[model samples]
Target: MTAPFRPLPFLSEARAEQAAGPRLRALRQAAQRAREAFTSEGAATALATCDLVSFPYPTVFAFSGAARSPAPYVMVRHRMQVVRFQQEGTERVLLFNPSDYERGHEAPFFKALREKYGTFVTTQVMTRRHGTVQAHLEALGLTPEDVDYLAFDHLKAQDIRRWLGGDGQPAYFPRARLLVQRAEWDAVRCPHPLERVWYVPEGTGGVPPERVELLSGDTWLGQGVALLSTPGHSPGNMSLAVATADEVFVMSENGVATESYTPLQSAIPGVRTFAEQMGWEVVLNGNTRENSLEQYSSMIVEKVFAGRARADGGFVNVHPSSLLTRAVMAPGLAPTITLPPPMSGAFTPVAAPRHAA
Candidate 1:
């Protein structure tokens, strides 16, 4: 059963760190200086209670499954991200495909890929230097227990058991509950031929039934937060949409980066013209041809979500969150990757779940 949401007193960065041990407290000293870089963007009301924490997890993969295409493969930048959603002083942690953080948790997805793909994925993608979410939260003086909710856009390549321990095993965050789509959970246990390589065996085997929250369709999580079923990459794939005062933001692998989302606007030479000539609709995030059609449709849903970033007509573009890549589609076409706009006081609350465009 899901526990009732409880609002905690907002902790100042300093006060939050006070409870941390000497070793853990030292993490804050550096973050204390880094905190100066976080801005509330003065007077601007945010669309949601959203915060973005990113680290490097580079990967070399194709932008889509389009064969005989220009810019077939490239390196990804800022691939790992931890998004926090807060409402009425209560907060939830939404990990965007959280896996492969050097020394954190290791998933079968990483191990299999390394064995098949070799050094690039092994040395650069899986072992990229990046701070783990545990480390980042500790810097903010928070532990997993402080988290109320955990979710992902989908379950592909996710090894979640370790994160939600049971059967006498200790979970990373004891009090937190996991939110997963029913379809996603089902697929994990019995994956399609294409995605089998991504699932961790018995990833959910040890998770207590009470620790899981299952969803069937698009649902609002809070005032300005939602999880949308944007299946394409996988049967149960989903995406997260958050509205803040400045603009709404989404975290997903639907389109690895900005260029994948808007191919026409892509800076990758010949991509725009080639896509136009080939009559290609959308690009799949993965290279597999299986479920290619769904992947294509999923990007459309993602495009709509990104467009909600601003009401006055701004479009949403992912910042390659956690993945830092030198490859830009084009200097003129690359969108500036950034977190949602900052908040001064109250966030721009969504009255209810709006229709997906």
Candidate 2:
């Protein structure tokens, strides 16, 4: 059985260093065990990615202080991961970051963008929606009713109201429970001034309390999947770890690119030199830096858990949930390398179980 979630402790520089060694050792062992179980039981069936939308994001935030590009913005495309697995002879589905694009614009950051860039440029020229999550589910022969769980790395632009039904509205995914960190739940409800910009106003307001599952810390959902608490970007930031046939994939918004974890090997002009000069191993996404040290530590945990990528040993298998994409709208700002959905196998929709008459 999986242990119940608990609160993660705050990490000072010294405390982070002290905890890193033991935490890494334990993570490695856990990953190894999960992999073995996956092979033996065939616990995991398939994992697929759905591209949602692309928009302009600040270049400075993408690489922290490591980027030297003249371009002010970089194009980033957000994606959702659908994982199919089984536990106790029952099939399950987990959706990671299934963002509601229409409701996303209410976020303060996008509001600011529209104010600065003009409505036409910001909405029409720069932002592009690939498809809706509902459409993606339809393509896979699944339904809103079929989704078992919904989660986010951290709820920035997210509004749980529509999905869970709030203020007397009907829910899109009627049966899915939202797995969110307790700290994150609090943070979103009462955002600090620094956090206000990334969130939507009244985003979680009126959402049914029973629809949310508040996790205290790290949690093992099943045999091949776990949700690891990794704070810093937000008070309750977490990453998804899934063990597959070939390798273990860690998904989060911890860093914007694989090169963010391996800056020394980055082909981006200033990244290598900046890493060497600063004597830093990883470059942060740096959107919110108030808790820089703790975020750094959390990122290190992600790096170790992901292990090195098989395609290129220099990089780790940390896939950014909102990946920096190549586009003409954003010039001179493309990631040197990108990892497509690394998990293998195709999703086969499981029929809903019949109840006794």
Instruction: Quantify all predictions' global Cα lDDT against the true fold.
Output: 0.50, 0.79
lDDT of 1 by residue, 1-357 (tens): 123322111212322344334423333343223212221221112222222223222222444433233432344443433445554444444445555334222445556556776857556653435455566556544566655567776665455666778556678867666777788888887877777765665666678887888776555554455565556677777766555554445666666655566566555555566568777645456634566655665465455444534422334443333232444422322223433432223322233322211
Task: Provide the RMSD of all predictions against the true structure, rounded to 1 decimal.
Answer: 14.5, 3.8
Q: Local error of candidate 2 at 118, Å?
A: 1.7
Clashes of 2: 2
Candidate 1, backbone clash total: 24
Name the lDDT of candidate 1.
Answer: 0.50
Error of 2 at 8 (Å): 13
TM-score of each prediction:
0.67, 0.89
Each prediction's total of clashing residue pairs, residues at least 3 apart in sequence or on different chains, is: 24, 2
Model 2, span 96-197: residue lDDT tens = 999986788889999999999899999889999898898998898788777888999999999878888887889998788899989999999999999999
> Candidate 1 — worst ten consecutive residues by lDDT sum?
35-44
Deviation in Å, model 2, residue 328 alpha carbon: 2.8
Clashing pairs in 2: 6-216, 6-217
